[model samples]
Target: MESSFSYKQTVPSEWVDYNGHMNDAEYNRAFSLATDAFIDHIGLDAKGREQYQYTIFTLETHTCYLKEMHEGKEFEVVARVFDYDAKRIHLFLTMYNADGEVVSTLEEMLMGMDQDEGRPAPFPDLVAEKVEAEYKVNAGEDTPKQVGRTIGIRRK
Candidate 1:
């Protein structure tokens, strides 16, 4: 029911790269943790997933790293539902540093999977409803500029 899902953590020293800031991989790691929290928001905890034999998979992801983060720095990842249907969700996750500035953002497409069949599947009715409700609350204004960017060098 809260507007969006959030996960917070401090950047461990191991996550830092030779450049002396957080590694690029750790930004994806933080967003991955945020997706776990988002799944819980839609009612698919470990018990529920086991009971329903359902799980979510990331179909694709686009990450834009806008700032640097050093070791031991605190950060928060916020997950928002850009859109969703019966089987898939377009999620936008943003990372904010301790001073509350946007440092990186990741946009991902996730699909529900039927574990037994090992294939994509629609979400359970309850989960679908919960996602729709959250989507309504999350798809408000001030959309992230990085939501749908493609990697390319703009020319001409």
Candidate 2:
């Protein structure tokens, strides 16, 4: 619940594309790892899965590639909760290179679901409380434009 939750990862060779940089898919992978870390921080993990039968599924995502990353590069991902309702949460993630420069940013919308029914459901009360606490603790001082954004082409 600090300003950001950080996770370190090494770029794998398979993540490199013909362009010789980390492929677009790997960006999502890194963000996904960060998401998992957040979930764990809030007490959601294999045990939560077994007991609550609840999990998050990504509904939408927007990623901006600001700089290229290469295979074997050590990088870090910082994630924070931007917003949340009963069933959905908005998260912002920044991928940083070894030098701490932001290499990419991703915004994602995730929905809590009942794994058995595959239907949307409100987050469990305990999980909801934890998430709310985290949001309060981590909300950034500056209002980031990425929060509550919709995908579209801008008209100049």
Candidate maximizing TM-score: 1
Candidate 1: minimum summed lDDT over ten consecutive residues — where?
Answer: 1-10
After TM-score superposition, what is the CA distance of residue 55 in candidate 2 from its true location, in Å? 1.2
Q: Candidate 1 on 1-156: residue-level lDDT in tens?
A: 135567889999999999999999988888888889889888899988998999999999999999999999899887778899999999888888988898998999999999999999999999999889878876567767887888889999
What overall lDDT goes with each candidate model?
0.88, 0.83
Error of 1 at 106 (Å): 0.3
Model 2, 1-156: lDDT tens digits are 245367899999999999999998988888888888877766678899778999888898888888999989999887777789998888888888999888988888888988888899999899999878868867665655655567689999
CA RMSD, predictions in order: 1.7, 2.3
Cα deviation of 20, candidate 1, in Å: 0.7
Number of the top candidate by lDDT?
1
Give the residue spans of candidate 2 off by over 4 A: 1-4, 148-156
Q: What lDDT score goes with residue 112 in model 1? A: 97
TM-score (C-alpha) between model 2 and the true structure: 0.86
- What's model 1's lDDT at 140? 64
